[model samples]
Each structure stands twice: as structure tokens, then as C-alpha cells.
Target: MADPALSPSPQKHLAANDVVSCNKKSIDDAENSRENVAGETALVIDSAAERALCRKFDFRLLPVLAIMVVFAPPFALLGKKIGPSRMLPILMFSFGSFTLLTATTHNFSGIFALRFFLGAAESAFFPLVIFYLTTFYRRNELARRLAIFYAASNIANAFSGLLAFGVFQIKSDLVDYPWRWLFIIEGTLTVLFAIFVFFYLPKSAAEARFLNEEEKSLAYHRIQVDSSSVVNEAFNLRESLQIFKRPSTYGFLLIEIALGVPLQSVALFLPQIVQRIVKNTIQVNLYTVAPNITGAVTLLILAFSSDLLRIRFPFICLGFALTFTGFIIYAAIDDVERQIKLAYYATFMMTWGTSAPSVLLSTWYNNNVAHEGQRLALTSVGVPLANLMGLVASNVFRDQDKPKYAPALITTASFGGFGILVSACLGLYMVFDNKRRDRRQGVKLSARDVPTSRLRDGPKVDDFRWFL
Candidate 1:
């Protein structure tokens, strides 16, 4: 047995008895520690996996993931060239083109490489956009505005299901394989849309065509007023690392991972699950869109409430709560009839909570961090890090996890529960973090509020607020 007297350091994750163990023992300890993290509440995957998962957001899984890993660094630094505002459209358009072209592939490898290319192109926008938008919007305004952008994705999700179902409905001969047509047509349209976004969208708050000079000034000034960071600040690796001083980042990341499998559970497996219940592939495809549509509406409603109340906790909590109940139904129900009903309801959790977190994390980080470099570097990792959990969730639904996929459902439900707890904890911590900072250094109350909360004084000492 291991020594109980010598406890591991509070900050260090160490084996109780094997501090000086041999190579095998070290490996065992390391494995055990990882298992503990998995069992507890760590984001199970790493950066590359997260980016791959995110990059694959447009395309399918395996091929897109490989491509995204290749493409990530360029997107990470894209702001230096065209800026985040301009880069978003440019990247999206690039991705759309590649995705559309995926129709002509002759083999799996061809599809794989092309999807990879698309992955590279699509990798730049989502995380950075959240960062950019949060700069112009206040914490109160963050979720709703973020939802505006995020809501675009819901359109894609809902439409993709319909498109897939419809395409699959085609007499396989004319389309030459409906699944292939699905890739080709969607990819092509996205490509064209990319061009439109690239040309029309603004470069930043300063340059947005839709905003009047007054609005631009107000937009730029408002964020600077509240956060004490400029729109065009450089990326900071060191300061981003300091975000670890706050545990919420990790907490959010864990939520992202836990939610990953469940969301994917639905995305990757939902149609298949429907097929098990319904005989017609057409019916399966048609039914897929319903949840996303409902989810999109739920998100819009929740987003408005989040902003209206000038609060993050309640809506986020509401999302997880809904998701948890959905998962509970999914897990607990055994009757084929009830299971199918519960499975359809599970979309509420995934479509709503799954998509909102990136927005929340983006808002939370952007609202808090004042250094441009730090914000860039942090968000650069933040979203990809969260999506990385997809790897963990992806593998859970094996062939063995059949019918109800009881194991997967139960596992995802546990994760949703964890997400609820973490969001609660993070919300409380944000309040506490502010109080401690204020008590110790008098930040963000009297004089600090002038620069940090109001943005009227221009950028000052890199102080900012969290979106909570």
C-alpha cells in the first residue's frame, strides 16, 4: 500500500505512494492520473483534437480533423493580416468553397484530404469572431449578439439535416450517391456564401459599414470603456497563461468536453438512432431537423433573457437544466416508444447548451482579459480546447452501445450534470474574483471603474471584466 502520511501537493496531481517509482510505475501513475481526470471533470482531449473537432464543424469527422490540425496556426495569427472582422468572412468563404468541392472526390482519401483542406480554412472564424464581437458588445449585450452569430450555425445544423435527408431521398442513380451529393451541394453553396461574407463584412468596429461613425465610436469606446483593451491589440501568450489563475477556464473547458460526446451523440448518432426507431431513411432524415429547429428557437429565447437580465448564470443554468432533463429521459427510459420520445427530446440539451458555451466562453474571456495578445492567445486555445472534448465523446458510442445507447446516454447525462455544476461554480467564482480583486487592490469599484468598467479613459493597465 502507498504511504498515507505524505500527501500529494495541493497544486500537484501526484500518486499517493509512487512519487519515486520506476519507469513503469511513473507510466502507471500518469495513466492513473489521467483516468482520475477523466473520472473527475477534466476536458479529456487536448488542443489538436479540439481544433480538429472544431474544424470538422463544416465537414465530416476523420478527414476534416487531420486538415484542421494543419491549418490552425495560420488562423491563430490571421488577425495580424486582415484583422478578425475581415478574416472571419475570408476564412468562412474559403471553407465554404472547399466544402462544396468535396462532391467530386473519387475515394475516401480524396474526401479526407479535401475535408482536411476545408478544415484548415474554416478553423479561423468561430472562436475569433466571438472574441471580436465581445469587444464591441458589453457583458449584458454579449450573449444576444453572440447568439446572433451562433444562431447562424444553428441554421446550418438544422438545414444540414434537412439537406442530408432530402439529398439521401434522391434516387441514388441520378445524384450518383445521395451522400456524395450532400457534400457537393452544401460545400458549393457555402463556398459562394463565403465570397459574399468576405467582401461585405466589416474589418472591425472601426470599419464596419453597417455602423455609423457614432455607433462605431460607441462600439469601440464601449468595450474599451468596460474592459480597458483596444480592438487591435496584439496577442499575448504569457497573459493568456495567467488565465489559469482563475479555475473557471478549466471548468468551462471540461463542460465543453463533457458536452462533446452528447452533442455528437446526437449529431453523429441521432439520425442513426432515429433509423432504429423508424423504418424509412427518409423519415429518419426528416425527423433530424426538428430538434435543431426547436433548439435554435430555445437559444434565441435564452439569449434574449441572458442579455435582458444582464446576467449569465441563470440562462446558462437553464440550458444545462433543460439538457440534463433531456438526458435523464434518454437514459432512464427503456420502452422503445418512450426511448424514442426521450431521444428526440435530447436535442434540446445539445442544440442549445452545446452551441452556447463557445459564445459564453468567448464572452467570458473577452469581457475579462484586457490584453489583446492574451485575449487572442487565450481564445485561440479556448474554443479549440473546449471542442477537443469531442474526441472523448466521439468514441463512446461504439457498436456495442446499441439501441438506446444506454451507456452513452447515461455518460452524457453525467456530463450535463457536471456542466451545470461547473457553470454554477464559474458564475459564483466570477463574482468572487471581482470582490477579491476589489478588496485587495481596489480594482473596478471607484477609480478602476473609470477605465475598466466604462472604457471612457481609453486602454488602461490591461484591466477588464468577465462576461458573467
Candidate 2:
């Protein structure tokens, strides 16, 4: 055995070691460190098996998501009355139960029925959440918050794909198909989360459990100062009807329809589109992950920029431009197999526009609607009407268009271009309309005199300029 002091310990070696040995040891240590780090990260880069699980489902099930229109309007109205806190929990529980039940479905009818109820349960969630958010946030604060909320959905979509990639790799003793496990695990999580939501989410800023009395009061007062509108005021019928008569409302409805077509189409059919380019199901899901993440990032960037610049329509136009150009490229590239890289790039472009218009369009009306009655009507009518484009989306990409959905891509691109035109026209109208209001008042009216406490009794349309 070596003497204790002379043994090759690092301390003893350092004292006796030559400069060349010390340098060599340092190089060895760095290489060893790199090897250890690479070993630790090997699992992260190795996802080949997980991606193999992204096979297509029967197209008939597409109606499950699209059917939300049937239940959305009435539910929006109910959520307005009963409050989203009460309604959201029940809806979450209902949909989560249905999603749980979907795993056991062996027949088409069972799947369809479950999907239908899922749609019913989720119909009002988005619009109601938007309406609920408006109660607390000021107009300037809304777009960013809404973008963040919307970004969460895109993040979920990205996460779900990544989750599916991993979850499908599990070798189950009880279940024959790993696909069934997807529904089982995700559905259970949703149910558990709904329970958490029920306990955690506050009904409104005033009722928020996390905030102190002072903070809650500040929250309430800020919204008051921002819009001079009452929070959660009772709805009115005659005044709500006035929104329907406005030309701007129709313009909004038309623009939403145009935007919704591509949005829904991509949301529902992305896996299928990617499958055409990549034969493997796992690769399809893997490929989709990048575009989705890009979309979410683009959405957040646009939203914060819109808030920073105090502009909405210019971003809306930019979103449409990206969407249209993507679709146009997709349409022009007839040889998908030969031009697969370009086709995939087009998907990134298509997804960039999906969240912007929907978020901004809703906020536009929410900001301008002024009173509770008009706000509720827009939430109830405009949102559901915009969702009606889902029906068009569900039917557009026919079986004959398999592999290359040229017609569907072109149609969606056309819609995007038309939406841009409508947006421009609406912007011009808002500018002219605001000018007319200023001339009528002989000066632009200030929001100071608007009542802060009463619902449906705040500033009139002429008193506030619309956000273009």
C-alpha cells in the first residue's frame, strides 16, 4: 500500500504534480464533467418511441368540438347571470366526466354522444372566461391578460402533444391500447384540476381569496376609473338589441367568421395535415409540437406589443397577413412530398394568426360595448355566431382532398384576405365614427362624468371612442 501522504489524492497530487500533469488533469476533468452532463440529458433527447403514438382518429368525431355553438349562447347568458364561478365548476366537472367516459367508448355513437356533451360542457368556457376577465382588468390591461390566458391554451395544446408522446410509451398490463390511456390519464387530471379550480378561483376581484380588503377595493376602483362601468350589473333587453343594429357589430361578426374557419381547421386537422407529410404517427405529433410552440410565442409577443403600442387593428392585419401568406404557400406547393420542408414552414405561419384575432376581436367589443347589457349580448351572440364557422370547417376538407387539401387551404386563405379587408374597413369606420362624435360634442368627451356604480348606466357609444 502507498504511504498516506504520497497516495494519489488530489491534495497530495496537486503539491507534487508538474504543470503538464495538472493541465492534462484539468482537461480530463472537463471531459468527464461533459460526459456526466451528456449522460444526464440523454433521456431528454431520446423521444423516438413517444412520437410513434400520434395516429389519426376517426374524422366523424370532429363534431364533438364544433358542437359548442349549440350550447354556447344560452350558457354565456347563464354564466352572466349565475356568475362564472358557479357555472365553470359544473361545466368542468361535466366535461371532465365525459372525457373520462370517452376512453371506454367502443362504438361510434358512444363517442359522438360523449363528444357532444363535451362540447356542451365547454361551449361557454372561453367566452365566459373573457367576459369574466373584463370584470376585473382595465381596458389597457386586458389584451395582455387575455393573451396570457389564450397562450395557456396553446401551451396546453403543445404540452398535450408532448405528453401524448411520452404517455403513449407506457406499457400497460390492463389496457390493450396505449391510446385509451391518453384519455384516461388526461381526463383524470382534468377532473382533479376542476376540483382545484372550484376551491381556488374567486368569483370576482371583490371576492378574491388571495387579495386583502385594500387590494380588492383597489381592484374594483381601478376598473371604475378605467371604464366608469359597474361590474356584474344586471342585464337589459332593449339596450342589448341596440348592438345588433350597429353596422360595426356586423363587421365584427363577419371578421370572426373568416378568422374562425382556418383557426378551427388547423386546431382540428393539424395532426392529419402533418401526417400527410410524415407517414409515421409519432413523427406527425412531434412535428406539430414546434409549430404550436411557435404559435404560442408569436401570440404572446403580438399581444404585449398590441398593449404597448395601444393598437389592435394593425396587429390584426399582421396576423391575417401571416395566415394568408402561409395558406397561399401551402396551396402553391402542390408537390407536398417534394416540398415537405416548405410545407412544414407554412404550418408555422398558419398557426401565428390563430390566437391574435380571436383575442383582440372579443376585447374590441368588450371595450366599446360600455354597458353590461351590450357586453352580455356581444358575448352571447357574437361569440356563438363566430363559432358557427366551425360547421363550415368540419365539412370543408372532404375525403377526396386527402394528402393535398388544396381547396380547403385556398378557401381558408381567401377568408383570411377577406378578414383583412373587413378589418381595414372597420378601422376606417371607427376613425370616421369617432371624428363624427367629436364634431357632435364640439370637443371629445371625457370619461369623468360617467357613473361608476350603476350597471347599464355608464357612458354612451358617442361618449367613448371605439378601439380600432
Candidate 3:
């Protein structure tokens, strides 16, 4: 055909000599460009259609409220049975089948069944997303990536009410009840996204398209200096179980519970709270959106701050303090107008503060606990257990609370105070332990030595510390 240099496809010149020469030049170029702090891949994926779908598929209350109340467990069980990779296509077909059923279901039990499957499918999602995100970004990069992911809550909070308003307009010719349409539209989007995930997501960093052999090696070495970066890995179930022995692992799990439960109060009940003020079901739904937008902005600020501080406990404690303040406004007030507005503001503050700690804390435990199994065990328990508290959270705003759930707000506030104390104590413990270990003869705590999923990505040796 053509001479190698003049080939139509630039990559056609893959001779053995060229491979090494290209790799070396690529490495040199990479070093010269340096680490790009601002990641723009998320932008690369965005088109008008993708942006609209991202907006439509926003999955607002799925985690904060929807999953436990209705949508998460069935697909999770299915993921166990069908395998995570296989679960999506299965879920897509199943979701479509159920959406049709949900559109016609005439009884509560049928409604409950549909909701259960929805929950199960959703269960596999959040954790997988977090784990998947790690395989793409380096360790130091994770804090920002996680911040963006966690921003979903803020986004949900910021916009849920507004979306409900628009969906309600479809009540006339939308082909289903407003509530039914909620399930149908969201479910369809889920199926579509599952398809995207299957095709595009890299199996691991080594498998990523953009990096070459040397860049991959550099990525591995930078992360491995502290995080125990695996090379062409194997799964280890035994190691996953060993994470339970670490006190820090359990501590972070407890911290997550403190963060996750209050989230539901805002995510699930806010619309219901609007019901108390506005009589129209649709309008009430619409009202729920405004506060969440405010909440999202607040969360962004907290996450950015947490990343900048490079500390977990202090931010966690601060989140608790903000949550407690909000709860106090709700708990201490009697006037309905004041209570509702303050309640919204309180939730906004709580959400902003609460979002930062999970990544920081989970990453902390993951880093401190060296074994892969332990990190997996801690994270697996930490997230679901953090969520399981929703069973209790759902009932906290009982019928007696009416427009002002003073008692529930108070209990939540008390939990917030408990979290603040726990984080403060943990912070002190971390400092003392770091000092004590410095004088001893064991594995010196370094960034690369930390076995967290985050550390296995990328972090400069000295700059990335197991600060938490």
C-alpha cells in the first residue's frame, strides 16, 4: 500500500522498533505535559443528547431516598445470580417488562413488587460506579472525581422538585399516571445507561485506551509507592473479609451511617413535606426541587474544601455540626412557615456538609488497611450498612409529626452530635497513632503502602498521605 509514515491510519506503523521508539517519545511528552489537575473526560462524553439524558437519567432520589424505600434490592440479588456484567441486559429487559406492568398495576402488592426489583437493580449501581471510577482516575485525582460523583446528591436535591413539576404536566397525554411515568421514564434511562456502561468502561486502568506502556507503568509506580497498585490483578475473596479486623474500617462505616440516614429525610420526605404546605400533589412535588439545588451548591463547596484540607475527620465533624444546626432549626421551631423554610435550609446545610466524608473516610480506611480484601470488606459493609439505616430513617417522620417533625428532627440532630464527637475522637486518635507508629519499627505509613482502591490509582509519594 503506502509507505509507513504516509499511511492513511497513523497507527499502521506498528513495527517492533517503532513500538519502543513511540513508547519512549510518548513517555517523554507525558512528563513534559505534567499532571493535569482538571480532568475533562467527563466533558468529552457530553453532547446535547448525552447532556439531556444525563439530566433525564439524573436518578435523583435513587440513593438518598429511592433505593431503600423501593428500588434497590432485587437487582442486587440478580447481580449476585446473573453476575454484574450480565445483570444490566437482564435488568433492561426486566425493567421494561416491569415498567409496562407498573403502568397497569391495580394493587399495592404489585406496586411493592415493582419497587423491590427497582431497588435491587439500583443496588449494584452506586458501588460499581465508585469502584469503576477508581480504575479510571489516579489516586490523587480520585478526590475530585469522587466529589463530582457525590455531587449527584446535591444535583438531586437541587432539582428534584422542579423535575416533578414537569413530569406532572405529562399527566394529560403522557400515557401513564405522573407517578407511573416516573418509573417508566427513569427505568428506560437506566436500561440505556447500562448499555453504555457495558461497552465503554475499561476493565481496569491497564486496559484504558489513552495510556501507553510507559505511562501505564508510571501510573502504577506512582500509585504503588503508597497504595499497593495491583498489576494485572486477580480477585481475592479471603482478603475482602479480613478488612473487618481494622478499627478504622469500622469507624468509617459508623461515620457513613451518620451521613447517609439524614440524607433520606431530605431526599424522600421533602416532597412529602411539601405536601403538608401545598395541597396540589404535583405542585408539592415541584416544590421539593428548589431546596435540593441549594443543597447541591452547598455540597460542592464542602467537597472542594474537604479535598483542599486533605483531611477527613475535621470535615466529617464539620458536616455533623452543620447537620446539627439544621436539625436544631427544625427541632426547636413551632411556627409552620418558619419551620418549613428553616427545615429546607437546614437540609441544604446538612447535605453540603455530609457529602465530603464518605470518600475521605472510606479512602482513609482503605489506605490504612493494607489488604485488598480488607478494603473491599470495609467498603462493602460501610456503604450498605450506611444505607440499611434507611429502614429506620423511613419511619422517623411518622404520622404524628404532621407539618413539623420536631421529634424526628431532634433525634436526627442528636445523631449528628454523636457523629461530631466520634469524628473528633477519631481525629485525635489518628494523630496519636501516627506519632506512636513513627517511633516504632513496622511498615512506615506511606501513601503507596496504603491498600485503598484510591491509592492504587495515582498519588505522588510524599504529597499523598494517609491523613485520615
Best by lDDT: 2
User: Candidate 1: minimum summed lDDT over ten consecutive residues — where?
Assistant: 61-70
* Residue range with the least summed lDDT across 10 consecutive positions in model 3: 61-70
Residue 34 accuracy (lDDT) in model 3: 28
Write model 3 residue lDDT over 1-468, tens digit each, in one string.
Answer: 679666545455457569889878876754442232112112233345333422322332123212211133333433433343454445554655566567668799998998677555545555544443343333444455555566665575556556756776674664646777766676676556556545543444444454567445444443333334453244555544545555665667677778676766655676665565567876665665655665555556665665565555776687778878877865666665645666556555655555555556555554454333344445556666667767767878888877767677777777788788877887788777665653342234433233333433222222233566
Query: CA lDDT of each candidate?
Result: 0.59, 0.71, 0.55
Separate clash counts for every candidate: 17, 2, 26
Which segments of candidate 3 are over 4 A away from where they belong? 1-101, 171-178, 229-232, 273-287, 336-344, 441-465
lDDT of 2 at 187: 78
Put the candidates in lDDT order, highest first: 2, 1, 3
TM values, all candidates: 0.73, 0.78, 0.72
**Whole-model lDDT for model 3 versus the true structure?**
0.55
Clashing pairs in 2: 51-282, 52-282
RMSD to the hidden true structure, all candidates: 16.4, 23.4, 15.5
